[model samples]
Structure formats: C-alpha cells, structure tokens
Target: MTTTSKLIHGYEVVIGFETHTQLATQSKIFSRAPTAFGAEPNTQACAVDLALPGTLPVMNREAVACAIKLGLALGSHIAPVSIFARKNYFYPDLPKGYQISQFEIPVVQGGEVEFFLGDEKKTVRLVRAHLEEDAGKSLHEDFIGQSGIDLNRAGTPLLEIVTEPDMRSSEEAVAYAKELHKIVTWIGICDGNMQEGSFRCDANVSVRKPGQPLGTRREIKNLNSFKFMQQAIDYEIRWQIEQIEDGHAIQQATVLFDPDTGETRAMRTKEDAADYRYFPDPDLPPLHISERWVQEERALMAELPRAMAARFVADYSLPEYDATTLTQSKAMAAYFEAVAKACSQPKLASNWIMGEVSRRLNMAEIGMEQVPVSAAQLAALIARIADGTISNNAAKQVFDALWNGESADVDAVIESKGLKQMNDTGALEKIVDEVIAANADNVAQFRAGKDKAFNALVGQIMKASKGKANPQQVNELLRARLAG
Candidate 1:
C-alpha cells in the first residue's frame, strides 16, 4: 500500500452506504401503530409502540413478506433462521431506549444491485439487509419551550440495507442511492420518500492508498436528500485529504450532515461493534422463512424499472435518454406509457414530457406521484397539435394554463383564450398579402432571386397572427407565394 493511501483515513476514499427504507406495511414492524403519513402527533402510537411494561411484542407478517420479496429481487440468500437483537442507544427520539435490530444472522445477505455509470455497467455488493424498528421523532417546533417527542413514527418498520465499501466517488454514491431508491419503490416494499424519512442514507467514508491499511472511517448519518448525500461525502473526503496532508491522524467517529453549510461535522467518535452490546431478544423467537414463502414472493414480482427502461428503448423507439428519464419512477413510466398508448407520436410524447411537463413539475416542487397534468390531458394536447387545430406555440400556452390552476379544460382554454393558431386558408392568405405590401423592399429583393428576403415576410405573417400561426405552414406558404 502506498504511504499516502495508508495514511486520508489511508488508501482511497472508500465509501459504503447504509440506507433505511421504511416498509409499505400499514402497521409498525412489531406493533400495531398506524403507519400513515402526516398523522397528528402521538395519535398513531399504540401501547406496544410506547414500550409499556407487561407488553409482549408480536411481529407483523406483511413486513416479513415484503422483506422476502426484496431479498429475492436482489438475488440474495433468504436465511432459514434470523434473530432480532437490541441495539442499545440513548436519544430523546428513541422511546424504547434500545432499538430492535439484527446482529449476527440477518434476513438477507450477500446480494448485489446493478447499475450503469455510463456505457459500462457495474454492480455494488450488499453486505446485508436486516429488519429494524425506527425511533420516534423529536419535534423542535410547535412547543412553547421544550421540544416535543412524537411517538407517531416510533416502531415504524425499516429495512436497514448495508453495502460493502465498493463506491469510490460522490457521483457513484449518488447514482447508487438513486438506483436503490428506484428498486425499493418499484418492488412495492418501501415508499421511498426521502422527505418523510422513509428513505435515508448513512455514508461510511474513509481515505487510503492503493494498497494500505484502511484509514479510520466516520459515519455521516441521515443524509436525507440526494444532493446533500453527494455533497457530504465530497466535503468529508476533501477534509480527510487535507488532514492527512497536514500530518494529522484520522479519528474514527460519527458525524452529521449540515445541509445549510453543505459540510459534515463530527458528532462523536465512531462506536465499535462491542459498544452497542447487541444480544438476541428473548421476547421474539427466530424467524424461519421457507422455500414456499420465497416462491410465493417471486410470483408477486413486477417488472423492474431498469428492465422497463430497456424495453421502452427497444419497443417504443425512444431515445435512451428519454427512456431513462421517464422510467426512473414507476408513476412517470406508467404516465408515459399511457400517453404513448393513446397513439400520440412516441417522440412527440417524449418531447412534451421531458419539456413542459417536467419543467412544471419541478417548478411546483412535486414528484410524479403528485403530477398535476394527467396522461389524457397531455395526449389530447398532442393530438390537437397533430390535427393542426393548435400550433406548437399555442399548445405550450395551453399547457401552461393546464399546469397552473388557470384552466382545467385543454380544448376550452384554447378557444376561450384565443390561443388557437390562424390555420384558416383565407385568413392566412390576407396576412401574407399585407406582409408582402408592408416589406416592399424585401419583396423586391425576393423577386430578384435573393432567397433569404422571404424570411422577413414570414416573420411579418407570424407577427400579424399574434404569434399563433403555424411556423411550418407559414414557411411553406411564404416560399410558394414568393416564388410565384
């Protein structure tokens, strides 16, 4: 190992991510607490979730089924026996004082998730995915003086997915997170809501040489956003490099992401496995998953989003870029397919989606799950343009109204707002004559064989039509009239 590598946390900027994906089950992992989003604080909590005395925990069957489905999808070995353990920790948010997690034998292990960085496809190895119970949330706001602890989120079912140190850069980290996000949501296992903490990442980062002892690593926790995850890793890497260059020894620690400053600060020295005092829980028995359950889950599998993207490229005749963008999320892929099924041109549907539809969705700070424009609305707009009832420019205006709250009816908005193009033969012919008369010098230049002079007349026709004349038809009419 090179001295430099043995020396940022030494070797390379080795990265491993631990992502927590909340299961889509209606109840908590081992309790009956309602798993609804945006519930009133403490209302969803049950006696079991509150960890009261004399309460015995019971595991949810649906949670197990969901985990098995995910395990099969990742091509992992479903262990015949898995045990739950208590990870002792102290925090205001943790109502149970100890988190119920897996220690020695987890549900699934030795799996792989595949992704394409560019032209080259690659796979990131998975260490294990275990079932864990989430802690409650501490609300710093809405209380007069003291922070409130909301147990509503407590006992929530979480699948903690740990990865091997295979990623080398922040870009790879982001891409890996994105690909995993797609997979969890696509498989109907997790909701994949980063904002709601349904999906979160803890980045394990260290620096080392080509061949050297690994440097002391820090765990950066709760990287809830994609941008923040990338930025935190990059900043931590640079900080480690600078520390080594300054002849400082790297210390193992736990850190948190400061999204406001786009940096990572050390929270505490990282804990070793022995520090947690993990042990199997006597209350809960070992979970034995059989071949029958695995087979049942395999039958319930849906086509993966990545495979769907490839099919769109081959069958729908879409650009790889378009297919990739539209198929990143299940809702978007379904919406795009509906538009294409409506017989609107495939390329045209792609253009509108990647253009105005995405633009408006981003502006509104919403994802495809809450997309305002429906497939039928988009398909109808495309059809209107195809039939020459509205020009491309007018369609954009109608789409704007459709995206915003201005208008709900695409066709009515076109007629009521006078946004339709001047496609009438007689009306357009009158405008063409006026444009020729107004630009006499240009008309003379065109008659004398200067082909470019006709552009001036086309611009005039568009201006006379209030910028609503079909530019293609205007150009064709201008060429014929000028040549004659």
Candidate 2:
C-alpha cells in the first residue's frame, strides 16, 4: 500500500497480481515427463500427463519441497495438509477435460511481499500460493488457418502466487513484480527467464472513483516483459476511466495485450469458481506433509535476498539502496564483495559498480555474467584510485584500456598511458605559486571571502598539471598558501 496520491481522472487505480513461476524440477508434478524447455511438441508429455487409461497420478516429492521453500521465503504458513482438485475446463491444449490445481485449501496461506516504491516501502498481501500443473500452449503460428497444440509444457509444475489489490499505480505494480522476480530467481526455485516463459504475470486491473465500491476488473494475461507490464496496466486504467466517464459500464473479461498496437483487447468472458466446478481428485490421496519434513527443508534453504541485503548494510556499512542493487543476483553480489574486499573501500566499490560498470553492461545489452572485466582487474583499478596513484579521470582511461582488452596488468596500463598522478610536492608548490602570481585579481577576490575565486585558482593549477594533479592535495596546498 502507498500513501502517496495516485489518482487518474479522479479515479483510483486498483491492481492485483497473479504470477506463475515454473519450478526448477527435473520431472513433471504428477508424471515422469521431462520438464525441459524447447522440446518438440508432444514429445515430452507421457501417458500420465495425457490422461491415458490405466495411468494414475503420483505426486513428485521435489515439487512439494519447492512449495515449502517458497512458503518459508515469504513467511507464509505451510499447511500441514493440502488437497488437489480437478478444475473442469476444456481447451485444445489440455489432453484431459479438467486441470489439476489447488482450490479450497492452498499450501501457502498468507504472506506479504515488501518492496520499495521509489523511497516508500510498500507491501502487497498474498492471498495464496498453490501448486498447479500448467496447461499446454496453443500455438497459432506455423499453421494455415489452423492452430497447433504443444503439450511439452502441459504437466510442468508451477506455483501460482496471488496478491491482493494493494498497488495504487502502475509503477507500484511493476516494482512489486520485479521484486518478486528477484526473490524467485535468488532462491533457485525459478530461472526468471521471461523469454523462455519460465516466469509470467497476469494483472487484474480496475479503476473506481474515490470512496466508491470496487470496479469490475479485467485480467491482462501473460505479460512476459516488465516494460510491457507497465504499459498494459497504464492503458487499461485509462480505458476504464474513459468508459466510466462515457456513462458506460466496464465489463469483466479476460484480455490480451497486443505489443504492436500497445492496447488490450477482450479475449473471452472471465469465469468464476463455480464455473470451473472444482472437486478433489479421486485417484490421488490427500497430500500430507509432516512437521519434520518442513524443518528439514527449512534447514537446507538458501539465504534470501532481503536477509543478504540487510547483512551487507550491517557488515559493510552500505546504504540500503546499494545493498539491494548489488544483490540483484548472486553473481552480482559475489562480484561486489570480491571488489570491496580487495580494495577495502566499500563506498568507492559501490559507486563504480553501480555507475560505470552498470552503464557498460546495459549499453552492451548483457548481464553481469557476461561482463568482460574480471573482479580482480576492477579491484586493482579501485586500489590505484584509493592510493592516489591515479586521478579519477585518469582511472577512467585505464579502465577503458582494460575493458577493451588493450592490457591485463593495471600497472602496465598506467605506465603505458602516462596516467600516474603528479605526486612531487615541491613541484606542485611551485605550480601553485605561479598560478597565484598570474591571477592577482582572483587572489584578491579570494582574500575578500569569495570561495568561488579560490575554486578558480585550484582549477588553474589542475589545468596546468595536465589533469594529472591530485585534486585533494592541490586544494590543501592552495588553502595553506592563501592563509599564509
């Protein structure tokens, strides 16, 4: 929830989220089918997945463990006993007439997702996160006026995380989605690959006038990219506002966003719980988990992102923002730690990594994993800057050489490019004296209590040193001369 005002056309936009995170299991939840991506259509699905006769559904223990892991990470209560139900539906992709999912009693009960909306902390309450098997995809392309069914994803295990209507604006919704993405990927339960359909989000968007009852909502399905997520939500908000303003009622339906058109179109009427006719599956017994098993899984859980970020703030004295950004991924956190430890300058390391390093990575359209420079190289560069061996500007040149594969050794790059800072005390003093004599007017202004004039004199000295002078040393010596 956000206290900040986010009203569009005198209407407050209400949003909820439903995210499907594909578990990193080797096999399907109730079958022996392989869960790998990019397999040939219908090749990976087995008899049990296809609902063939003489096949009985058997639950996978690993999937249950994954559910337990998510419950612990979100601070949710893991149900000691849960049931699987057959949700009756019909589609070309579903081999069976019904899909298996959790309806009445979900595994993970109630939790909250906390994230920062700019500088404000916001939390979205979770309704439930339940284990379900995904329906196969209906492929429209590569066909002549006919659709194709791909059952490879039919039986994949998924954790459906539902959120309350806590987001007030599209920005908050996007922020919440990204934070959830980082958590799932950090905990090793999901790959967070949007392109590969590993993680997907459905946004339930509605708009209502302040103090009015909740508006009818439309769900935008399969928003695979964060950029598109924001755009889709924003568009839907505007559309709903316009419809209400025109004296028309908003209809509840399922919609799809056309990225090319940048608008949402109605697909079909949305279905309620009664329409699905859910009933407990007869073949499978009640899914039960003992307290001992929950403890065992909790003991083996990895450190969550929020906890790690808090640790960085406490141990290294970093700002909360820096810690969060550095821990976006495990590899990124490891790289930052190595650089900070090697140079013994946590703030400097944070600045460089977040600024220049991130700029280069974004411009190249790659992640930290594909970054060309090694941690050791960056550490040595920062160490030189700390020791006054090179000016900050000179260090950039050295970094460029290292990043461009011109040289591997930091010292070699410094020497070859003549980037070493001028450390000769006597020579610097003489340069200070010459600049003072030539700038009598500026000197008079400085004596008259003008700080800008003093800065001008320091700039002259740095220019005379060919941008190689240590700025702090120059400032100190100039201050001493003026006082004398």
How many steric clashes between backbone atoms does each model show? 15, 0
Model 2: residues with Cα > 4 Å off, grouped in runs: 1-3, 141-143, 448-450
Best TM-score among the predictions, by candidate number:
2
lDDT of 2 by residue, 1-484 (tens): 4446589978998999999999999999999899999988899999988888998889989989988888888899999999999999999888888999999999999888877776677888999999999989898975578788888998899999999988889999999999999888888889999999889999999998888988999999999999999999999999999998999999999999999999999999999999999999998788898999999998998888788889989989999888888888888898999999998988899999999999989998999998888999999999999999999999999988988999999999999999999999998999999999999999999999999999999999999998888899999999999999
- Measured with C-alpha atoms, the lDDT of residue 329 in candidate 1 is 80
lDDT of 2: 0.91
Q: What TM-score does each of the candidates earn?
A: 0.77, 0.96
lDDT per residue (tens digit) for residues 134-191 in model 1: 9998888655776888999889999999998888778778888998998998898988
Assess each prediction's global lDDT (C-alpha) against the native.
Answer: 0.85, 0.91
Candidate 1: where is the Cα deviation over 4 Å? 1-13, 31-57, 73-75, 85-99, 112-123, 135-155, 193-196, 208-215, 260-262, 274-284, 301-303, 367-372, 404-412, 416-461, 464-469, 473-484
RMSD of 2: 1.7
